[model samples]
Target: MPSFAQILIALGAAGGALAAPFANTTAAAVTTEQRSAAQTFTGDITYYQPGLGACGETSSDSETVVALSPAQYDGNCGKTITITKDGKTATAKVVDKCPSCASGAIDVSSTVFQSLADMSVGRTQVSWSFN
Candidate 1:
């Protein structure tokens, strides 16, 4: 006895109600992972020229590319990291390995380094985590 418009409205309402629980579950999962993914550590950060890097990736100043220590690079290649310093933060992709860097040092592209600190500073203490 319900009209076509009424039937569609009822179906839409039911569909929305059914989808709400799934949506909330997905949102909760994402929030939980984001909370756990943040692991902070202090390190020395410096800038480098944009060019071919040890990971065989060609980069430029315009891109947010970063070089990690050999150990970090082995596991983090092609992953993103969020670096923070002097109350500023920048996110960059791990694209290369830094054999010369100390165990906790990281080298970022000129743009990413500048985002966290002035180029004249050359190097600064930074905290970073995988995003």
Candidate 2:
């Protein structure tokens, strides 16, 4: 019942998917070497509402997302970063740019901030690194 053209198209799609790298995998694990090589930065961490980002992605405030300073944002879109505050750690993707943030400081989603410190604290000192 299928047309010859339709069959060929379906098979081509299947073959292309099979050849795609890590197409069948979920998140890739970051190697320890990559983690150790990431330079740690310390700064004041603050929270922000989310929407369309400087990286050209739309995100939710409930998601683990972060806005890095212009100095750290270029070429790092979609990269994951590990943030630490008072021994609490949360991993968030770099999704936006923080024009107001200082060189080392970062702006994170409300979700990321709440996970590490109480919202009442407003802002807190945190150390972070790309992962």
Candidate 3:
């Protein structure tokens, strides 16, 4: 015969097991949707570095612009933007604008470039397709 303590534990376990199904059903019934919002810009449209100031300051540090797909320009900045180069996809951000940027190209901050591509890489032939 089980001790009183053992019977209480067994009853507790059975109660927990019985509640598990209802708990799971309730949890599954709740719907969770992840939202992806786009970023909107309407100012002078420029980015600045630590000491360099605005887009144009140092000629040696001319900004680099990488062309992105139509989907890439969904106007999202805070969110991560996927960049693909040499069959490798890297995540970067839509930080700033390059007045000198070629058509369909986007100019990311040097910090962002360092994150997605190596510093020595200069410029990476990449394509961005965002959601």
Whole-model Cα lDDT of every candidate shown, in order: 0.85, 0.89, 0.47
The TM-score obtained by model 1 is 0.68
- In terms of lDDT, the poorest run of 10 residues in model 3 is 39-48
Model 1 stretches astray by more than 4 angstroms: 1-38
TM-score of each predicted structure versus truth = 0.68, 0.71, 0.37
Please provide, for model 1 over 63-109, each residue's C-alpha lDDT reduced to its tens digit, 9 standing for 90 to 100: 99999887567757788998888678899999888888887689989
Expressed as tens digits, the lDDT of each residue in 1-131 for candidate 3 is 88999999999999999999998877665532122223321111122342332333332223433222333334443345555555555455443344555544555556446655576766545555443
Screening candidate 2 with a backbone cut-off below 3 angstroms (N, C-alpha, C), the clashing residue pairs are: none
Q: Which sequence of candidate numbers ranks them by TM-score, best first?
A: 2, 1, 3
Candidate RMSDs in Å, in order, are: 9.0, 11.1, 12.7
Best candidate per lDDT, number? 2
TM-score winner = 2
Q: Given candidate 2, what's the lDDT at residue 96?
A: 96
Give lDDT for model 3: 0.47
Residue range 1-131, candidate 2, lDDT tens digits: 99999999999999898867564342233454456447899899999998999999999998999999977888889999999988899999999999999988999999999999999999889999988
